[model samples]
Target: MSIRLGNSCVNCQKYEDHFCQLHETTVGTKHTCDSFDMRAAIKDDNNCTTCSRYMSATCPNPKKAAPHMLCNHWAPQEVA
Candidate 1:
């Protein structure tokens, strides 16, 4: 499988090829079938290097009750 970095993930310099604590290591796939936090999506442009939602452990949008998938905030990296 191929793992694509989303726009958000790519924007953050702190995020590397090694993240995703649920898998206990960087996942190497388009998207993992594991449960991940949704809050990690809200990153502070001036303060945070990346959003905590990358793996916070809870869905911020509980009203939607979205499925447990890779960070929805993740935007597939653009190919030049």
Candidate 2:
């Protein structure tokens, strides 16, 4: 399976063990099937400002961003 860094599956709700939960089968990370539903990343009250992928006010993976600008790969930055 070809897995990419910014694949849609990284944040998909149905993504489990590189498998598609809805399809009940394994799927390639690079694959975007018809059932593809973008998953929203968990956000804090501060929102994108605290996201790991938020760098210099730009998102490395724009496709992962929801209409509201929330990203699926938005992980909270670890406290230094």
Candidate 3:
């Protein structure tokens, strides 16, 4: 699977306060690398409970989420 820095990095475990713990440096939201791992997305001061892609604070497509950011692949969560 291909990963984009902007969408993927925001939810990565290494990302902290705009810095990457693994890389030991600050990175932009659009930055990417091979060490990306999907963590729960941030809330961005909004409610994701209504979003279709929101899965208990996780996004399945990108395998990530962010409080203030949404990926291009965002979809409405289906109602069962």
Identify the leading candidate in terms of TM-score: 3
Name the better of 1 and 2 by lDDT.
2
Candidates ranked, most accurate by lDDT first: 3, 2, 1
- Could you list the CA RMSD of all candidates, in the order they appear? 14.5, 9.8, 11.5
Model 1 per-residue lDDT at 45: 43
A best-first ranking of the candidates according to their TM-score comes to: 3, 2, 1
Model 1, 12-50: lDDT tens digits are: 333346465445555443444425433444332421113
Q: Please, what is the whole-model Cα lDDT of each candidate in the order they appear?
A: 0.39, 0.59, 0.61
Among these predictions, the greatest lDDT belongs to 3
Model 3 scores a C-alpha lDDT of 0.61
Q: Which of candidates 1 and 3 is the stronger one according to TM-score?
A: 3
Q: List the residue pairs that clash in candidate 2.
A: none
Taking the tens digit of each residue's C-alpha lDDT, what string does model 2 give over 31-69?
A: 666666666652334446666666545576755544336
Model 2 residue runs over 4 Å out of place are 1-7, 42-80
The 10 consecutive residues of candidate 1 with the worst lDDT sum are: 42-51
lDDT of 3 by residue, 1-80 (tens): 97443445666878877889998988876787899887664433343444666765356544456545566555445311
In lDDT terms, how accurate is model 1? 0.39
